[model samples]
Target chain A: MKTRLTGRVWKYGDDVNTDVIFPGKYTYSIADPREMALHALEDLDPGFVAAVRPGDIIVAGKNWGCGSSREQAVVCLKEAGVGAIVARSFARIYFRNAINQALPIVTCDAVDGVENGDEITIDFAAGTVKTPRRVFTFPPLPAEVLEIIEDGGLIPHVRKQLGR
Target chain B: MGKTFAEKVLAQKAGLQQITAGQIVTVKPDRLLTHDNTSAIAATFRKIGVARVADPSMNVIVLDHVTPAANETYAISHQATRAFVAEQEIAAFYDIGEGICHQVLPEKGHAWPGAVIVGSDSHTPTAGAFGAFAAGIGRTEAAAVMATGEIWLRVPESIRVQLHGTLPARVSAKDVSLYLIGLLRADGADYCSVEFAGEAINAMSVGERMTLTNMSAEMGAKNAVVEPDEKTLAWLAGRVTQPFAPVYADADATYASVIEMDTTTLAPQVACPHTVDNVAPITEVAGKRVDQVLIGTCTNGRLEDLRAAAEILRGKHIARSVRLLILPASREILQAALAEGIITDLIAAGATLLNPGCGPCLGAHQGCLAPGEAVLSTSNRNFKGRMGSKDAAIYLGSPATAAATALTGVITDPREV
Candidate 1:
């Protein structure tokens, strides 16, 4: 599935870990998308919750989610309505977690070019990213990786594999 | 082709003995665990339109990061986790008062030898202490595990860290681990399973082994595994319900790389500010001045760790200029320390005791550093701005070194203490 992100890009510096992604304290809050949404990036970027818009992608540097393998990190990103994340490098777990949740974690070297709020389109199938100013092509995901994303992460994929 | 730990584990889980590169091997996790920080993984299942977790008994959720509600936001987050656990019927939902996931998980026996354990936190690899090929996965991957109990991976290569010589009385496994981290650099073991095999490792207690494996993530390695022995089995008897046996790589087992460490004359090592790779002999930074000395976290917050710090703290008070926060990783750990009077001695000597949790480790609350302040911490991760302020400097060391630093108010060798 292809989705377009239209909000201002909320830029963050390097090593945005699970602690900063969703601080440990908020993990106990209600699963109501709004409550979970309110605390997104509360520690690293206090204004992140108020500043983000649905479908905005976060651009990060190497080793994104470097510390703590907390899954709440990804939940906060998804609940904050982040459509996709593009980074130069990602912690192994965060990379797979984002894709399995179908949150669209893509890797690109030119992330430094995309400023906050630059209207962009990420076409999963085309393996390309579009900014009004430039059309950037990303390396296509491997077939298996794409299959998992298309199946909406591992659960659905496993269900299909199991024919349940 | 030679198989890596990740390859062998995945192949077994996928019901196959071998899988080729570029092929998808859907791996069924033998155990799944997460803390409050990444509970969002279970939420990802909802986003993808799935229902209950794949298996309640096999999955566990823990509230570790924000223990005791450092802020209103923390309070709210804890509530969200409770709701998720109750709604999903996840059997092993450890609440805020429970303790750090890393310490409590192994204590409770969720991780077993030869199992493939996954978690949302990078440090999940600490389970490798049990001889499991444990790795950290992302929330979405965790969500997939929650929904279907499986995910795919490209098995990583293996790196053998061979240690020789006996550990000095003052030196513990933390010193050895820091020494290795210093030598290998933070990214030295990246994406590889670091197999620790040596007299020093086998002779160390399970607590020390856990401390070693717990910090494997600091080196950016997938995990650290010990060839489980009597010490491991003793601990596992009361905790693990699953049937298992210790698994070790064969003597002729292939490795992507090998690094040798000789500890006969090794001195106490310290990971200085900004990065865990920052290393220096504790003597070099001593008496420079310190603002805080934190003694807890998943890495080195157990009773034995606290005792090691307290033994050094006995008869010596923390410098008036230094604030020492002594947080055990769990309630049982706290009890052990208290029962042994370690906490009282530490407290009487000017150490502040906090609850058992992952405080200060993430800089969210408790023992944060101010700009220009320096802290000697027993916890893992010494990144810039990691504690509280970006300008603050952190020195990572063993509990003994951390205790010694508290007395001198800067990094120092325990031998001199």
Candidate 2:
């Protein structure tokens, strides 16, 4: 599976909670992927939906996506066509949920150097991020974990391996 | 190979002789839980036209939030949840004033020791008080669990927190947890189970242990569990409908890391603006002044938390500049606080008590802060705009600090009380 990613990084400030990722009230009527995509980051950034594109990533400081454990926060990003999310850190639940849903979550320090809209590249195997200004190294994933990301999600991957 | 809590629980529930970490396995929970806040996931099931819960007998829903209908929006949310539960014939549905989902689940005996449980609320780890191996999941995950009582878990590495010494007066479990958050930082236990051990943890009461394990989520821990003891068994004897043995960590358990704390030397630690990790000594941020002081939520919105706050606020009133909102986690807590005279005393001290529910913490209901206003709150998260206005500042601390700030209308140490 491919282990490299390059994208324009969207910069978000600290404590970008699940609510800001996916609003609450809109949750009542629709679970369609597009419904959340329309409102992604509406609370935090008004034009986030329009501004983002597929393969785009978000760079944030500590406690990124930290509020209530809502899966839609990830689904919103998924529908927003976010290819990978690289942050300094992630809330444990978001990290787990994002991985489970097959969203690429890369944690790399030196996100400050990767400005918004700057096309950045991530190499999951080498555990490094490369941009115009700097090359940021990250903690690499174990081969099995990389396989989990490669096969899409836990259930699908497990099903395939077991031939079920 | 050494087994993790996840491995053990999954193996037991899957009816397997052996299981490995890194392998795919399904686990049946002894109990399952969801609340009004995450009931939206069940709503998603309605989209798929899942007419019935995957397992009606095991599922439970508690409407702790939006209780008393803060407004029309929340009322509708609760109504939708009720519709789903009634349609599915889910036996464990809890309605208005049913108590914080965590507090009620164990107090009512649904949680059993060594039982693997899942809930939509992140603090479902609170059921660890009963020695249940409980963890929180998101709505889709909850929905998946609702569909199949099995959910996948990556066995987390374990971290041992061997705490020594006793807490000083005025320093409660909240203070101890804050101290741990400060020392360990938010991601200190990322993807790891924090096993609370040592003299201090063993000496703590069941409720206090629950308080500790409950907020391990704040530190991004996978689960925080205390090795059950006589206290846990005794706490369960009267409450549990079906008796169960308490689960204890192995005597020679392996841990990825170990943390030590002397509770006596710890003062109240406060998480400063915007992040749970931005912690510092309260003395550093005291007298910073506040526009609001909030005391309550799933974190510290119980009767004991209220009593602690009332003890600090009884003879004093908040400053004119501050608005103090005290919300009980449930109507039961409210009644207990009122019976203990804490509620009336809090109201007399100029504290506005809201009906039992998660109010300002979500910013969906009451007590939003205006721009430039600062608040000392006991709620779990102090993320920007979390309480309505993005421009407002939040300082996270224990209920005592929240109460002390309510009394002085500025941040102060509860030790002064």
Candidate DockQ scores, in order = 0.28, 0.34
Instruction: Please provide, for model 1 over B248-362, each residue's C-alpha lDDT reduced to its tens digit, 9 standing for 90 to 100.
Output: 5656656878888888888888888666767887677766678888888888898889999999999778888889999898888998888999999999899998888888877
Q: What is the lDDT of residue B195 in candidate 1?
A: 85
Give each model a TM-score.
Answer: 0.83, 0.88
Q: Once model 2 is optimally superposed onto the true structure by TM-score, how far is the C-alpha of residue B195 displaced, in angstroms? A: 0.9
Model 1: lDDT of residue B51? 69
- Write down the lDDT of every candidate, Cα atoms only: 0.76, 0.77
The most accurate candidate by lDDT is 2
TM-scores, chain A, per candidate? 0.86, 0.91
Residue A72 local lDDT, model 1: 60
Candidate 1 on A1-164: residue-level lDDT in tens?
56444445666765566655665434444456567778777757878788787778887766677666555667678888888887777766666667666777777753666776676677766667676667666787778888877887666776687565
Report the alpha-carbon TM-score of model 1 versus the true structure. Answer: 0.83
Q: Candidate 2: misplaced stretches above 4 Å? A: A1-6, A12-16, A23-35, A42-47, A60-63, A100-102, A107-113, A121-164, B1-11, B14-24, B37-39, B46-50
Q: Could you give the interface RMSD of each candidate, to one decimal?
A: 4.1, 4.0
